[model samples]
Target: MIRFVVKRLWNGALTLAALVTLTFFVMRLAPGGPFSKNRKLSPEVIANIEATYHLDEPLWMQFGRFVWGLLRLDLGPSTRFRDYSVGDIIASGLPYSLTIGFWAVIVATTVGIALGVAGALRRNGFTDYAAGTIGVIGIAIPIFVIGPVMQAVFALKLSWVPVGGWNDGWRSLILPVIVLSLPNIAYISRLTRTSMIETMRENYVRTARAKGIGEWRTIWRHTLKGTLLPVIAYLGPATAAIITGSILIETIFALPGIGRHFVDAALNRDYPLVMGITLLYGGLLILFNIATDLVRAWLDPRLRHDG
Candidate 1:
């Protein structure tokens, strides 16, 4: 287990290095430099700024310097936001994103698993039909549409919830979290239903039934052992996405999150902020992937022992 963990950590570090290299150069290659604006910088000012950021150096040399900074755990100061460094910008925005993201995943996983289990147990009955229908609706509706409809009904028409603002209490999050999780919940429900159906049909399940295992225990324990692996596999993507925060969702709700911050940064051509946000997102994604891998290994002895 120690050797396995060390190997995974080494792979993760390499992946992060590659991601940082790709992002740093891609940001550098975007049409405008950090200093580009409506009014061109005077030649002297341009030269000065370039020298100050070491942008005057050859691209390869500057890239080397950037990697070194990353190694030192310094993301450097924002060229546009005078008071902030790249790290500072990310630090400030992460909490809001995380807060909404946590509730979103909880809603998705709990509802999806319960509904899926019900759908499988009921087969073609009313519960199965209802779960399937709701899942379809959730998948069909996009977040952009869901966000407005939620804002309209919950915030505007009924006024049961505020339209936006973190300070407005947790009620402010309900609509956004629901909208964000809806699609994921739908997808997971479908997976669970299919997995449970197959697991229920297996000979082992029949043997369990013959041995007089209760119906609930047979499904919950014996059948569910196989079902969780698929769910965990799907969670890696879901985790990364939730952490990114739905930019559109954040915008529609006027939430102060990394997603909205990065959107605002793009409009303003804030290079440092843009790089910082993407890097932070990439780092989070790597961490989540590592976590998922560990979880998968833990859940399956074959995988754990094999690796």
Candidate 2:
């Protein structure tokens, strides 16, 4: 177990290193160097500004400084928000993102799994058809489309909920979270339906039936237990996707989250904030994946014993 965990941690470290390097070069490659304005600038002024930020130094030297900062957990200053460091921006913004992402995951996973189980159990019936239709619509509609229509209907037309803001007492989050979760709900539901259906046909399920076990008990004990593995595996990637997808969702809703920060950083070419946000998100994904893998291995005894 120690060896396995160590291996996962090593891989995660390598992935982080590659991501940082790639993000640095890619951002640098983009035109305008973070301070290029449409307005004309005097030569001495430009030199002074460049010198102030050490952009005067060679790229290799800058890269070295970046690596040193990484080792010290110091995300550099933001280009757009001159007074704030990248770390400070993240510190303030992460909570908002977490709040939305947490609610989104809960709603998505719970509904998806339940509807999927019901659809599988009632295969070829109305329940299955309804579930499948809902899933299709969720998958087809982008969050951008869903967000506006929902805001128009619920907030504009009905005035039932605020269009956006953290002050709406959880009600404000209803639309955004639903829109954010729609795709994930659809995908997980489909996965769960298929997995449960397949598990229901296994020899153990047949054995349980032959033993005269109650229907609910047989399903809860056998089918669900087996189907859990795939669901667990999907969750890791789903979480990463959900958080990244929020980059658009938060921007549309005008929520103060890391996703929105990422958008702002991109437009302004705020390299530190952009790269910091990228690394933070990447680290979360790696950590989630590793956790999911460990849980899967724990749940499936064969995994740990296998070469």
Candidate 3:
């Protein structure tokens, strides 16, 4: 297990390095500089701005400086947002993102797993049909469409929650969290239902039942852990994605978060901010993947040897 973790960490480090290198060069090579939108600036003024941000330096030299800063855990200053470091911008927005993502995941996982288990146990019944219908609707409809429709009905018409903005506290979070979790709930429920069905048919499950174990006891003890395996595997990347924040969800709901900042930075070609967010996201993804592997190994000891 230790060896497996170490190997994963080493691979993650290499992947992060490659991500940094590729993003650095690609952003630099893009058609526009960070100040490209400032049409009225004089040539000398532009040169001074470039020099200040060290865009005037050779690509390799700039990369070396950025890497050195990274080593010291400094993400450097934002070229677009004056007087703000990359870390400062992220820190300002991270709380909102984290809050939305965390609640969304919790609700989705709990509700989804319940629906899945109920549907699997009562196959061909109303609960199974209802769960199936939900999965279809969620997968078929895109969030952009879902977000506005929900805002219209739940917020605008019903007045159950505010239309947008973070000022209303938890009420403000309701719409965004629901919209964000909808698709995930669908995916997880479907995945769990399928895995549960397959696990229920496994020889061990049959053997447990044949031994005269109570139906619910056999299910809880013999079936559930195996059923959750695939669900946990699916959650790694999914969790990372939501935790980083949903770009469309943030935009539609007017939530201040890293997702919004990420889009602006990419569009404006803000190198430091863009790189910082990318590295942050990449690191989170790698960590989640490693965690998933460790979890799978714990749930099923067979994986430990494969690792």
lDDT of each: 0.82, 0.86, 0.92
Over 4 Å off in model 1, which ranges? 261-271
- Residue 97 in candidate 3, Cα distance off native in Å: 0.1
Q: Model 2 residue 110 lDDT? A: 98
Q: Give per-residue CA lDDT, model 2, range 200-228, as digits (tens).
A: 99999999988898999999887886887
The order by descending TM-score is 3, 2, 1
> If scored against the real structure, what TM-score would every candidate get?
0.92, 0.93, 0.95
RMSD to the true structure for each prediction, in A, is 2.0, 1.9, 1.5
- Cα deviation at 170, candidate 3, in Å, is 1.8
lDDT of 3 at 59: 91
Q: How accurate is candidate 3 locally (lDDT)?
A: 0.92
Best by lDDT: 3
Q: Which residue ranges in model 2 land beyond 4 Å of their true spot?
A: none
lDDT of 3 at 86: 96
